[model samples]
Target: MILDLNQFVSKERPYWDELTAVLKKQEEQPDWKMSLPEARRFHYLYQRASSDLVKLKTFAGEVEVAQFLENLVARSYSRLHEKRGSTIPFRPVHWFLRVFPSTFRRHWIAFMISLFSFLIGGLFGAGVMKFAPQHKTSFIGSFSHLSGKPSDRVAKEEKKQFDGFERRNTFSAQLMANNIRVTILAMVVGVFFGIFTVFLLFYNGIILGVVVFDYIADGQGVFLTGWLLPHGSVEIPAIILGGQAGLIIAHAMFGWGTNLRLAQRFRRIRSDLLTIVGGAALMLVWAGLVESFLSQYHGPTVYPIKIAFGVLQLIALICFLLFAGRTRQPDSIHAG
Candidate 1:
């Protein structure tokens, strides 16, 4: 076979340069994390450069070009292999501020599906309550307290004084435990192809919708907002995150877009699953504390302040999920 070395070198030089630039950036930012597309591109460039090195070695006249290719291949090889070989120590701040949110963004579509399912359930429940008020007991039967009029509950709650610190702490702990259990169940049930996950989310949303509609219809909307928004804002989103994680697991189970084996798919998503669930758990803890200490309180004097606080917290959370851990530019590979 005849070889055109000059043409081959010209064709591949751009790739070589691009790979060099990527390697340089990686060297500069040891802790930088690449998106999946960027990672794939990096791997492709590495393999291509390695192949170029082999072909160059076959024709011995271009010693300089061959050495350059060899060095580029070696650097990429070391960078790639060292990461797999090494253990990166966990940094809580970094994980919370970057890893968790970035992962949430990565699978935003799943989160949207989870959210949409919940909203649909909420609408259905609200419709039932609005038109068929007699069936309210079917949904609120589990909570004997909510069976009464919302105005009555609000009046009774406002008349009561704040419970002591010890009682509130105990209540907070109990709330945290219950919420965490529910959230974990939402995630673990993804093993059943996420069917149960969607059901759990929908069911919870139904209960919420029923309660909200009941209160609003009775003209207790202010009380409901003051009572729930403080903690419910964070708590509801946390549960949705659980649903998100569940859907992710379901996707892996289905092996939607790849030919990877079942075990391989699960392995790839394991870290992301852990990060999401862990973040949701933390949010639940905060929600529980707020529910016990602040949300349980009710009065005209405190309602406005509580509503403001809840709104601000919710805005902060949305911003964090949308923008946190976002880099100035993606680490993309292009011809240099």
Candidate 2:
């Protein structure tokens, strides 16, 4: 029911003022704790203010009263319900499942550029090693000696990585450290206007290609597939994402579309980079574990298992990036 604007204000203003004072006290004195009776009174006042707001809207030309009620009710609701600062719960699982994938989807173009650069570079390198074997040393120096030799060198190098430590644990840790180092390097070099990031992607791709060709030349294709794909599937994508993060920063600084102020753009870019880089690091840790423990074990018995595992992992990763955090688009129908 409608009342005179003056009468409505006269009746409701006291409750509004009381609720406002209670909320304000909490704001002003951090150490001031509300007593149980006071909290119950505050909640009752909040309910009264909400009901008053609905009534005030019924009075035509009571704009000022409605606005005051709106503010009072909001502050009271916040005081009673919202958690602030350190009170908020931290859930890593929620962040990974929801926040990370959404961030990945937002900056997917950078990932594509990184992925294509590495893949094309690798394919080109492989073609060169196959057709122009004479120049294999020019591209891949250390691996050059392995060409046409037995696969013993590859096995020996694996052994060397785990020489001084327990096989699974320390080797996994070392592998993680090394992979993280490379990913960080890729990210750091993106500051060179992304020129260095591009170089890194191509370099990594080329090395992979050369190594694969070398293994093939020695008639160890299956062995290389089991060892490489298991970890490479995850590790390579993570490294590319790190590069993607850096390139995003480079783009914010120098590339096209400077509609935002420089500081504002950089702030937005920084937030996106944090999520991308963090997710990439997590992937690298998984890759390192697989590389050290699973990929290195390449006998006939475990060969098919490793290859299948790699395929499944790669598929799951792709699906996660593509579909996770995606909401169905609303229908475009509109009422006439």
Best by TM-score: 1
Q: For candidate 1, give the lDDT of residue 101.
A: 97
Model 2, span 1-336: residue lDDT tens? 557777767877788888888988988986777788998999999999998888767655477777877888888888788556337486788778888899988988888888888888899889888898787777767655455454786566545533333568888898888878888777777777788888888888988887888788888888888888999899999999888887787787685766887688877777577788888899999998888877766566677999999889999999998888777899999989
Residue 86 lDDT, candidate 2, scale 0-100: 35
TM-scores of all models? Answer: 0.73, 0.68
In candidate 2, which residue pairs clash?
none
Instruction: Choose the strongest candidate by lDDT.
Output: 1
Superposed model 1: Cα runs more than 4 Å off: 1-85, 330-336
Measured with C-alpha atoms, the lDDT of residue 43 in candidate 1 is 96
